[model samples]
Target: MGGGRWTVVLDPHRWLELRRFRGLYESGAMSLREIAKETGLNRRTVAKYLSGRTPSAPPERAASDRPRRRVVDEVAPLIDAMLRAEILLKGAVIHERLVAEYGFTINYQRVKMYLQEARPRIAEELGISPGELAGLHRRFEVVPGAQAQVDWGDEGKILAHVGIPKVYSFHMTLSYSRDPFCCFTTSQDLATFFDCHRQAFAHFGGVPMSIVYDRTKTVVRRHVAPGEAVPLHPEAVAFAGHYDFDPDVLAAYRPTGKGRVERQVLIVRDHVLAGRAFSSIEEMNAAFTAWVPLRRAKVHGTHGEVIGLRAVRDHTALRPLPQSPYVVAQRHLRYVGKDCLVAFDANLYSVPAFRVRPRQLVEVRATKSQITLHATTPGAGGETLLAAHSRAVGRGARVVDERHWDGLPTGAGRRVTAGGDLPAPLQQRAQDSSSGSLMALLNRAAATQVEVGRRPLSVYDELTGTRPFTTHPNTKETP
Candidate 1:
């Protein structure tokens, strides 16, 4: 054996054997041969061992005791207790605790070495160790437009429908590229869930190869068995099927498995979705659609590349958008009343009275610029349409039903003098009852003005003057 020391960890018994042999050699009581035979060591080797020499230790044993501690006995218990309590077991915290509580006066790293001896304990406390964590990883690849991540971000609220409060915002992201799709959503219900997906797809301009969703109730129903399987929610499954992409779900309590998507949600909340105010979901989405693509045009932190350009390159892998968005929200069915009006949201909206039937399924769309209604029927399951209305408010003759003669209320007629021949709304002369009213006075002025041509001051002066003579002789000749 090349010369190296073997640590004698057995309590002084083994050391006593060597020492007694040394004693025999010093006292001249026994030969090295007798001592070596009794101890089962080569006589020369026993001589060397007793003489304070060493042999190589086994590899596993050597690694463990490599860093000898200055104060292992003094601080070992304290390190054990700290780890048991799950206190953060960094060297600094251990050192502070040792000095403050246990009266340890050793150097900080002396405490560190003691703690290092107790490393196995601390690693167990942190759930997965560095080695385990490193091994339990997944390699995520983005097939460009083929895979994206969706999640909810921060929420906001405002008056959505009188007393009803709406969620202000949530976040969605692309998995492969770290691209974000974010917007406001009033609910995590099926309607809003699919709507957010619609907006996200529009934002990304394509579907992903697959989408990864957490086992949120908004997406998954319930686990069939603990750690076994989770049933995808009916609505979410239908939506995924409609999109024609594979649906991937992380296990029930395994949040770390989807950390990539979770991180994207946070980044979008911090950068894209927060600190903005919007009046309605539509308005919020409009803002998001505009803002997100411009953000994509900029560079990314992860890839150090332009996201928009990359997205363009990746888009070929995605499925084309459906001709129409999926509709899962319940719609109201009502009639255009005989008065050519249908009331919704505390406002009277008129549809073409004749074109609407008594129990027609009509879709009412109240957008920023207009309010419209489309009649729906069963044969095409809302494919066949009947009539539509141009939304009107403080009307200047807005057409509700084409059959109605005057579609607008009085306020509307009062605002327009579309034909200049009609009297203006502000200039009514009904209060003037005198024969010398402005009309009568205006008649006399007209007679003088025709004779005076454009000499308006002369006509006014002649009419107001005490003199009654008005007509010139050249003006009367033709009569």
Candidate 2:
């Protein structure tokens, strides 16, 4: 308190000096000048610091007692507003904006320091504590196979040169072991989501007791009011049922709940995708597969154990995979064509003529090797099978069954061929024609249709008063 630069709270050493001076003065062993000379202070300043009635101990000053004027002080309200709006603006960005838009003349470092102190207060006002902020995520561990966290990370413009704008990675990490599995996909649709789950399960050699997922639409169908159970997508429920694992969805706006997979997404990006170019999702996935083994061998930072060793314990605790792998078939509503076929995957699949009408909506359930069509029925089961066709291997292929078109008009129905064509009866008749004398026979048969009088050349000769069997007009012998 004696000098502008010193306060008991800000400069505890100066408080110690004050205490020493007070002690020397009280003992009557040293003059104020002597204490000042020893402590390196003016006698008046030393006396001012020692003026307290009985210096017991330096009292800790309240944080509010610190100097109030700051560059951030002028913009604290703005920063508070930004934080309250859930805008995660960086301190440097805020500083630049303050300079450009608000004409703030303060330095960036002061603004940054103020922001660090102000965020806790701002979060408190928003009904969330500083510890719950996005940056101050807490770490928790789950028992082996007790849980696994799933997440998706977008790799932007990864294959832009090959015409792909973006790709996503599905990541799943065992909570206890921190073991991770990731795969790249061009889509985040329900099919791809379920497919990723299967891939991760296969990689881990089994399914976990429960899998935690973000509030993605593929997992959580909708966000319900607080205290109400979060509704899960029906397909997701079916998939979990098939695997005999529970699906745990994190609450809305709480990605840290699935922190294991969230952190692994970053690790995979940095280790596998950083500075890497891929022409296809398959190639990116291959890269991830090759790099994941390296990660598994490294020592985990938090667990302080070899990840592969920990993962061995995880795999042993995981639930055994079902006798059959869960089939994740993509469902789509397709209009049946007039040819008694439904189009799927750029291939035409036959639907029984009696089962589906032209332009009627039929649900196509497509798996890797099969495409099954189901017609919605009014009964309890909801859908009736129309047909199941072998999945086509290439585009523009037509897969048909002859029985499907049994009800078509008589000649309209034809034998099915591997080429997907229905051979017409006329084509069959042409194929059965004899090879020899075909041209001459065709000419003679064509002459049968020509009109000829009964008299023939003799009638023409009598009409002209000429010989009846004249060989030539120029001979004139018969005349």
Q: How many clashes in each structure?
A: 7, 0
Q: After superposition, how far is residue 471 of candidate 2 from its true place, in Å?
A: 59
lDDT of 1 by residue, 1-479 (tens): 24543443453544554555566567676677766655545566676665666434311123443443333465777677766654344565566556655787766534554565577766676564533233355655556676776667545444444443656455666665667777775556556677778877876677776877777776777756666767877767777778777778876666666666677655544343333345666776676566565567668777788977776766666788888766544234556765666665446666554455545557765432345566664335644344445444433443455454254354654564332332443235523545334443334433343432266566777788744556775686555
lDDT digits (tens) for residues 324-419 of candidate 2 = 877777788999888988888788999888766789998899776678888866435665888888878657999989998886787755554433
Best by TM-score: 2
For each candidate in turn, the TM-score is 0.39, 0.53
Q: Which candidate comes out best when scored by lDDT? A: 2
Evaluate all candidate structures by whole-model CA lDDT and list the values in order: 0.59, 0.75
Off by over 4 Å in 1: 1-139, 156-168, 273-279, 329-479
Residue 402 miss distance in model 2 (angstroms): 7.4
